[model samples]
Target: MSDTARTIGVVGAGSIGATVCADLVLHGFRVVLVDRDPAALERARRVVAEAVRFGPMLRPGLPRVGAAEALAGVTTYTALEALGGCEFVVENVSEEWETKRAVYRELDRVLPAGVGIGVNTSSIGIGRLAAETGRPELVVGIHFMNPAYLKEAVEVMRGAETSEACMAYVMGLLADLGKEGIVVGDFPGFVSNRISHLFFNEAARLVEEEGVEPAVIDQIFKRCFGHRMGPLETADLIGLDTVLLTLDSLHESYRDDRFKASAHLRALVADGRLGRKTGAGFHAYGLPAGGTGAAQG
Candidate 1:
């Protein structure tokens, strides 16, 4: 697709949303990012700029672009109507049903007919979200991990009514961004979160019940399992609040106690220790949260 024809909309300005915006910009796609919070938009912008500027240092194969040029490629807006002109949109709103439902309703009204939407969710089913719009065939689940620019693959969920054409289009788009799509069913939590959240919750339980040091628990997983990042470390990176929210969602959808969140996890959010974003959660951090088009939803 022509760069002009490929203008994409990204909704939400949280960790994942900002990171996705950067990945799009890095791959030379102009973006329109929307969020209710102005502060988040600003933060997301910084994220894109920094991710672009320093991207080449981490991976020599990455294209190096100045912050100004990279930042110039994206537009951040508070109004959802700004997305009307986008050819495709990636929805990364909060994991709450009502919040996502409201966004889908607006997206249905704003986007042109036949424009596909990528629902970047944790546990919500693609079918449920697609049902909110008149065009179920165009909605698909596109779950991206945090710090998206570094990820080489994404979980692509195909809903009951998701069209083959839409699937092809999204796969092509991911390829353009230097990533692959692993298609899966419309099951709640799909594959990643349904399984990963268990590790996070159980890790927290171990900490609370057994009094195991968080670092030691994480070390065991990393050393013994050959995992890149441990459960506790990942929880902090994803923001403990987000992990807990996702765990709650899985529990509600499955009604399984296995998805039940640890009480310690709940208490951390209540105490305002939200992980790296808040400078503390499972571990304390030294840096402040900052990134922006003007970015974070």
Candidate 2:
């Protein structure tokens, strides 16, 4: 696809969506970020402004747009119809199936038939979502890591009805965005999530079953496996709610006992220890490193 034909629309302007938009703009693609919440839209605009001011991924000496002008090329819309002419649309909503279905249905009704739709779901079934869109041929799964712009690996999934042209378009697009599109099936918890969850689940099991401290487990993984962050720390950064939801989705899909969400995770959620967002999780914040007496959340 031509660079000018790469007008993209993002349905969620949260962290991931905003990162993607900033990256797209730096790569010369017109982008529109859509969200129902004005606060989310404002956040997206601010993120874009920061990225532009710093020449996000661009050369250090290059001129960058200011806050007001950085968002000029990127429009924020609350209505789905605003995505009508976009060549690609990415959904970044929560993990709920019904919420995604509603967004897909709305996009399918207003978006041009030639436009492609992608979802950022970490564990949901791509085929199921495609079916709900009523345009399976144009629906594909493009999973970018949490920090979308900085991450180079992207999980690209194809549904049963996905067309070859659509796949080619998506792969080519990912390449343009400097990403490695690792193609996977429509199975729930596709490659990365399936493999990574084992590490995270094992970490949780250590805390719940063996009485191992969360910091100790995290330290072992980091020291032994060369992982930058331990599973618990990663979960804290990703939000406990998100981690539990992904695990639950995987469990429902594979019916595997291993994929089950850990009891410790549920307990943390119940106690509102939702990690950094809530001020506490496996470790207490604003304390001497590794203290775990529960700060707030």
Candidate 3:
């Protein structure tokens, strides 16, 4: 399909989903963003607007479109059926098996035959996700990083039955979004989360067990290791709840203790401190402004 004809459907209007929708629309692709929560949809609308106005500063090569023109290509809906006309679908629901399974089942029934479904999961296996859908050969993993628009690379994984045609289409779509797809084999957690989660979990443990401050751990990684963001900071940005969920999935799949969720992380999530979204996690933020919160680390 041609770029102008591509109307992408994005499920779940959370940070990642909203960011992806913004990036797609910024690049001149019509997008249908789906979410069950009205509040989330509203937040996504604001995110897209702000990204359209200010994102060019960070990504200078992006198409220079006004907020109105960028938003003109976006359609937000709470119904899954609205995605029927989309040429491709990208699912970014919570990282849970049942949630993803249900979304894929609905997409299988609604989306036309041969349309590819990209599962943007952090830890779940693409093979299992594909198994839950009727069109297994069209389901692939397109794991975009947090803040999808700013990131220039994405991890793509193919299920056992994913067809070559589907892979080609997904790769071409990523190119259109100005991203490099690092293809990897189907595995629980894939490459990025498998290794990154290890670092995040270990950092959480240090805080809980050794009484190390969150800032200290992050500072060590940033200053000593020459890393852009520390594990704790990265976990906060990714949402502590998501980090815990990923750890649980990794531990279950690998049967290893290294992937165990940290006690501190669990406590924070139980307290409703879901990082930047909730205004608190490892760090604190001020009240949410314009439906978005600033990360204060």
On TM-score, the stronger of 1 and 2 is 1
The lDDT of model 1 is 0.87
Top model by lDDT, which number?
1
- Quote each prediction's TM-score: 0.95, 0.84, 0.95
Error of 1 at 22 (Å): 0.2
- Identify the superior model by TM-score, candidate 2 or candidate 3: 3
Q: Mind giving the per-residue lDDT tens digits that candidate 3 earns over 37-146?
A: 98998888888887877677776787777888877888899999999899999999988888888988888988988788999999999888888778899999999887
Error of 1 at 123 (Å): 0.3
lDDT of 1 by residue, 46-93 (tens): 888878866666655666767887788889999989998888999999
Give the clash total for candidate 1. 18
By summed lDDT, the worst window of 10 consecutive residues in model 1 runs over 288-297
Number of the candidate with higher lDDT, 1 or 2: 1
